[model samples]
Target: MNKPECSRLYKVATKHVCALLLCFCLSLSGLYRVSAQDIELKNPSLETKVLSSMLPDGWKRFEQSPDVQPGACGITQSPYAGNTYIGMMASPDWSERIVQELVTPLQANKTYTVSFKLAYPPEYFSSSVCSGSFAIYGANELTEKGEILWKSPAIMHQDWKPYTAVFSTTKAYKYFITGPYMDTICHNAYRAVLLDDFSPYMREVPQIIVQARNSCKGEQTGSATVRVKAGQPPYRYRWEPGNFSDSIVKNLEKGTYKVTVTGANGAAATTFVAIGENELTADVTSSAPICHGDTNGIIKLNISGGVSPYAFSIDGGVSYQDEPLFEHLKAGNYDIEVKDGFNCILNVNNFTITEPEPMEITAANASAVSCSSVKNGSVELLVTGGVSPYIYEISGQSRGYDNVVSGLDAGDYIYRVYDQHNCYVEGETVINKEWRDCAVFMPNAFSPNGDGMNDIFRAKVHDAVTEFRMAVYGRWGQLIFESRNPNVGWDGTERGSGLPAGSYLWVVTYTDSKLQEIQQKGTLVLVR
Candidate 1:
C-alpha cells in the first residue's frame, strides 16, 4: 500500500459523506413542505343545513337511527366564528356524535395539537338539564368507540370558549369524533354543546438561549441578554414591565425579570432571571372557624416588597403553593411561611383560627297526617344561635327562608339554615298519619293598630277545618262584618271608617274533620 492508494481511498469516502449530507437536507425540506399543507377539513364551520335537519357538509353520524341522529337546529345566538356550528345531545342512551375524516392521516408516532371553540347555548327545551361537557376522540376510522383524546370540564356559559388538547399516537389517525363520555347519560335537556373552528397542527418545541448580568457592588440595576439558537430569526421580545422590542434590556431593578421571545413562525420560548433581593416579608390575616360546617375556615397572606411568583406553606416549610390563600383549616393555631422567586423566605407564626358559637335549631310538624293526606299538615321550625337574617333550605322542599313549610305531602324532610356568613346548620323532620280534631277559637279582644301582632279580629282554626263562617255585630245587633273563609279577619272599621274602640259581639260556625257542625257566640273588645 502506498500514499497514492491511500489518497484515492480518502477521496471515495469523502464523496459518500457528501452524498449522505445532501439527502438529509432534502428530507428536511420535505418535512417543511408537508407541514405547509393545510389540514383539509370539509365544512369545518358546520354551515350546511337542511330544514330543521342540520347536517354539516362533510361530517358523519354516530348512528343511523333517525330519531337519534345528529342534525342542526336553529340557535338564537350567533356562531362563535362562523355561520353554523355542530351540536350533540348527551343522554343516558347512546350519545349523539358528529364525525368527519381528516384530509391527511396523522403521522404515526408524531405529536399534534388540536383546538376548537365550544359553547353551552343558553336556550333550553323542556326537561333540559344543564350539562356542558363533551369528549374528543381519534381513530383510524369511524367506529362505536375510539381513543378518547380529551374530555373537557363542564362548560356553563352561552358565550363560546376555546379548548385545546395535545396527543401522540403510535398509529395514524384518519378520523375525528366528538360526543359525550361513554358512561355519561344525557337525560337533561341542557346536555348539549356547540362546536366550531376545529383545527389540528404539528406542534414545534423550541430551543433558545438567555443570559443575565447581576448588579455589581453599589449598582442599583442589572441587564439581561436573549439569543435564538435554532429557530427562525427576526424574533420579537416581550419583557415583563418594559415591553421592550430589542433582545438586550438594561437598567432593570433588583428583582426578577422574565422575557418571552417569539419567532416569526409562531415558535416561542420563555426564560426567567433574578437580580438581587436581601430579604422578603409576608403578613397574614386569619379567619375564624365557621359555626357548623365541615369546611373550617380560611387564611390569606399579603406579600409586600418581594419577587413575583410567591409560594406559601401552612406548616413550617413542609409544603408550598403558588396561591396565597389557604382554606378549609381546622380550629387551631398555624405557622405560615412564604418564599419568593429569589428564594428569599418570610415566616408568620402564632396565627389562630377561633371557633364560632354553635347554632341551635329545632323542627316540628303541626297537624301531622299520613302520606295520603300529608299536605294538610304544616312544618314549623324554631332556630336560635347564628347570625341573622338567616336563610333556610329544606333538603327537597324549600329554597328560601321560612319558619313554616305548608302544603307538603307526607315525606321525610331535611332542612338547612344559612346565615350572613354563609355558615349553615342542618336538621331533619317528618310528617306521619295522626288525624286530629279541628276546632274554632275566638279571641276575647283585638287591636287594629298597624303593629304586626294581633292586628285583626279573626277566628283561629286548628287541626284542619273544612268549612267556616263568622259574623260581627255592633252593640245593637247591627251586622258590621261577615266572612265565609276562616282566615279572613276584620279590622276596627265600619264602611271604611275607623270605628271607635268598644266591645262587639261575634258569632262563628265551622265544620271540623271530627265534627259535623258547631256554633259559638262570644263578646269581643276592640282597642287602638
Candidate 2:
C-alpha cells in the first residue's frame, strides 16, 4: 500500500486499540456499557454516585466524555428522568458528547421518533455555565461522530424542557450519539446542558374505545364496555367519577364517565363516555295553610317534559299518586319526586309548606284576685298574628266585645281570641288570689234599724286605697243603693225614702295601691 493508504489504516487501527484498552479498563472498574438488547434500557437512571467521565449502563462515549450526574462536579440538579441523567458541556475548545451502539440498526427509508428532555440550572459547577443547544448523530463506530441526524435550538431555560425529534434515514446506522452543539467557539465560557430519558423504539399505543347504551328517561339502564385497542396484554382500567376498575360499567345514570387504561409498559391513555337520558323537570308551588292546625295546605306541580300522566310523590317516593295538586298538607318542608309513564323521575327539593304567622297574644295583663274574695280578678290582652276583627272570649264568662275581661275568679281559665278567618288561638291563664294587708272590714249580716250601733252599713279602711265603690241590690236584683265614697253609709233605704227591710246583696269594688281592681260581694240582713 502507498504511504497515504497506509497512514489512514494506521490511524483507524490506533482508534480501535484505544477503544479496546479503555473498555477493558472500564470493565475492570465496573463502568462499561451494557448492551442495549441485554438491558432493554433498564436502569436508565443511575443509583449510585458516578464519576464525571463515566456513563451509566446502556450508554457509551466516543472522543469526549459525558456525565451520569446530580452528584458529580458540584451538580445537584434532580434527575429529570429516573434517578440520575446525562450532562453534556460545550467549552471554548470543543463540544462534549456521549454515544451508544444500537442492537437494531436505523433502517433506511423509514422514519424513527424519539423524545428527550434538557435542563440548564439550579445547581451548576465545574464550569462557567451558559445557554447551549444539543444534536444527535448516527455513526458506524464508537470512534466517530458520523452524519448529523437532528439538532435542537438554543436551550436557555432553567427548568427541564422536552424535545421530540423525528428523522428519516437513507443509510442504515449502527450507533447513536448525543452531545452539546456549538456553532462557533466560545470564549472563556462553558455551557452545561442536561439530557435525559430518551424514548425507546416503541410504537404508539392506540386510543381507547368505548361502546355504550344510553339510559331511559328516569331508568338506570345505561351500560358500557371500554376497549383498549392494540397494546400489551394485562391492562388495568380505572374509571373516574366512581373509581371503578371493571372493564364493563352497568346501571349508569345520566352523566359523563372517564376511564384511564394502563398497560404493562407503564403507558396510559384516558378517554370519556357519556350516557344521555330524556330530560324531566318540574316547577312546584306551595300554598300556606289558612288556619293554624288546619291541614288544608296544597302543593302543585307544573311539570314540563317526559311522557304524560305524571305521578308526584312528596314522601321521597314512598308513595306516589297521579294528582299534581296535593292537598290536606301541613306546615313543613318537602322533597318531591315526579315520575313519568316510563318511570323516569325528576327530584325537586325544598318544596316548603307554610302556615300563617301564628296568632300570638303579645301581652296579657292580668290583675290577681284578692284573698278576701274569689271573683275579683281582671285580664286585658294585646293580640297579634291572626287576621283582624278579632273577638275575645273567656271560658264560662262574658268578655263582651272587648279583649279585656274582668270579674274573673281565682282559677285557671282558657281564653280564646278568634280572627275574622275564624282561626282562633286558645291560651290558659291563672289568676291567683293575693292576700292584701290593707285594713278593710265589711259585715256579712248587719241590721240597719235605728239604734245606737249597727244602724248604718259601711266599710272600715286604713291602708292605701286608691278608689272605691259600693252598691246594694234588693232580693230581686234591683239596684237600690250606690255610693262612690268609702266613707258613705247605706241605711238600707232607696234615695231618701224608707223601705221594707230584708236580706240584701252588697257589692264593693276598690283599686288598691298596686293598681289592682278587686271586687267583693255578700249578703247582709236588713232587720226591720
Model-by-model lDDT, in order?
0.65, 0.70
TM-score of each: 0.35, 0.32
Among residues 3 or more apart in sequence or in different chains, the pairs in candidate 2 whose N, CA or C atoms overlap within 3 Å are 218-344
lDDT of 2 by residue, 290-384 (tens): 88777989999889876677888988999989899899898888898888765777888887887777799988888776544345577888888
Give the per-residue Cα lDDT of candidate 2 at 211: 88
- Model 2 alpha-carbon drift over 4 Å, by segment: 1-18, 21-39, 46-54, 61-65, 68-85, 89-99, 102-119, 122-192, 195-207, 211-222, 274-528
**What TM-score does structure 1 among the candidates reach?**
0.35
Global CA lDDT computed for model 2: 0.70
Least accurate 10 contiguous residues by lDDT in model 1: 64-73
lDDT of 1: 0.65
